[model samples]
Target: MSEKEQPRLASGLAQKVVDTIAPTIDRHVNIMNAHGIIIASSDAARIGTLHEGSVEAIRRNQIIRVAQADDTAGTQPGVNLPLILNERLCGAVGVTGAPHEVEPLADLIALTVQLLFTQEREHSRSARRAAEARDIISALLAGHVAADVIERTLDAHGLRAPLQLELWLPRSEQDPLLEQPALDGARTCWVGLFGAHWRLRKASDEPAADAPNANDRYLIGPAAEDAGELLAQAEAMRTLAGRPAMLPRRELEGIWNQDIAVAVARTPARSLKYLAARAQVLNQEQARTLLVVAAASSMSEAAESLHIHRNTLVQRLERIGQVTGADIRQAAESLRLQHAVYARIALDELQVF
Candidate 1:
């Protein structure tokens, strides 16, 4: 950790400790930082002031006792005990009474301060590790880092892979279930909030034993060497979520490659933005009719699916061609129109508007 980022016993916590300790011990108590500046004290005037006896206690890593007769600048008649956390001097605690009388109370308060500091440091370290883990996952999925680099980075964070990635989108932003850990039995798992969704990656030999509940949508990507492919599968899953024909319990694995319609849907919005814009010329009914025609086996089947006469379907198709400047009768033109429909769906799912 950087020097500036190193955790310290916060002043508020120090004050609370002083308040707790003061009731039991008749002596006034003060908490001082490493620099000997008083952070919290039972005597309010002492706060923000330097305590010379506490400075000496920290510098010597031992107790310093001052007498009233030997008063010096910033010195008080009390016992100062250095607060040590993990073998390092973090601060000091001072008790305002005769040296022999308050020495034990000062020692007890110092121990409490050390314990609190250790706990705070551990919590800080855990938070920093979680943030680093999320950054690595995001970079890998975005294809900004190569596999070799990711391997090294993960190792540096003490994370190993053979990892599984799961994408989840909760129905509500404040869902409490999102607080649950991703995989209970994995060696180590990292869950992060990515905009409107959550991304979970775990290092495990096999899949998670349990799945998330129905209140949230999830797509579990297969274990693979390339994370970019998993990202593409997530994109395809999002596109499918917006489709009317998508089943509630559909398996999303391999949908990007095994299904031609989904494969076309996976096309990046930037690549099909022009066609999506041109598609805007048609109304919602015309667009729906076009998608039905492209999906159905025959013109009559398409009309029946849309609950319209074949002639009406024919006229709508002709009008769609005129608006988008594409002949829906030709095979290639029909495929392009289908791709445009998927692109629109993908863009909408992405919230590109």
Candidate 2:
């Protein structure tokens, strides 16, 4: 078989298998890869050594029995069985003993190794598919692919169109929600890790209630064509969720019309820069004072929370207003300042600034 198509023998697993089978047969067992290089053996010194009989067995895909008289350098009197997985030559198993006595043990070891190879191959394939799914979803969300191309790509990947898309903003990359079993439920369902969230797209027939519980804030976009509308809605929900008042909710549930309003209200480029510049100019104490004043009910409460006299709090607020061009005492301007803060946070999350 070609090298790329050869089933690999996991050395560590092969070693464990050899160790487990060696004692039962009372014979030294060696596992050799398709190249005839010993990877695992009860006799540690034999590892990395080439076995001529094992190499022949792999080449011929048949058992080879080496007699003591026929043994050459690095060759032992043993029964060497070719390891085959899915009709592909993977490796060989050798048991050192009389041919009649060790042939059965060699066969058993070969079967065990074949089974292990199959399991590892499946695990590797699944991981590869998951990564491909992530890449495709990220590209779609980023608007890198045309609608027709996306549909074709989805079909190629065994997913149908008119898919329901959900954006999961987990607390962290390692959040337990990412491990939920529901993520793997349907072959048609695709779950992928996006920049700061997990994106899930499911068939229309599949109910959204069946999705895994992320146990954190998530936005469910309406099912739409080209996934373009869903992407926009997801961004809008993210901006709204960035606001302080909405930060505590565990889930956004579904897209709302008001999300468009929030998205449209995003601070303009000039205003974003102005807010950022103002923040950059503030000292740590001034920044904290501004935050406290914006969140507090009154100047007295703000002073108490900051552990400062009311007069001192008033002076800090006035100084902050003079520098940032926003009067904290007025409700409308205070709300504007808070919105600017939220805008900065949203932009940071979106990696826009």
User: Which one wins on lDDT?
Assistant: 1
* lDDT of every predicted structure (CA atoms): 0.65, 0.64
Model 1, 229-317: lDDT tens per residue? 54455455545444423212223321122254465455554675775665667666776777667667788988887789999988898
Q: Which candidate is the best by TM-score?
A: 2
TM-score: model 2 vs. ground truth: 0.55
Clashing pairs in 1: none
The per-candidate count of clashes, in order, stands at: 0, 0
Q: Estimate each model's TM-score.
A: 0.54, 0.55
Flag regions of model 1 displaced more than 4 Å. 1-26, 35-39, 42-50, 65-69, 72-75, 99-108, 115-119, 126-130, 140-156, 170-177, 180-196, 207-211, 214-216, 226-353
TM-score of 1: 0.54
In model 2, what is the error at residue 350, expressed in angstroms? 24
245: Cα error in model 1, Å: 8.9
Candidate 2 per-residue C-alpha lDDT over 1-353 given as tens digits, one digit per residue, 9 for 90 to 100? 23457566789989989888898878989999989999999999989999888889989999999878453475667898988877778789888888998898888888888787778776776676677667656655665566677667666665564555555555566766564432332332236443445454655554565454545655555665655654565455455544423332232222112432264346564565565553444555775566566556777987987799999988887887888787777877765555554445444522111
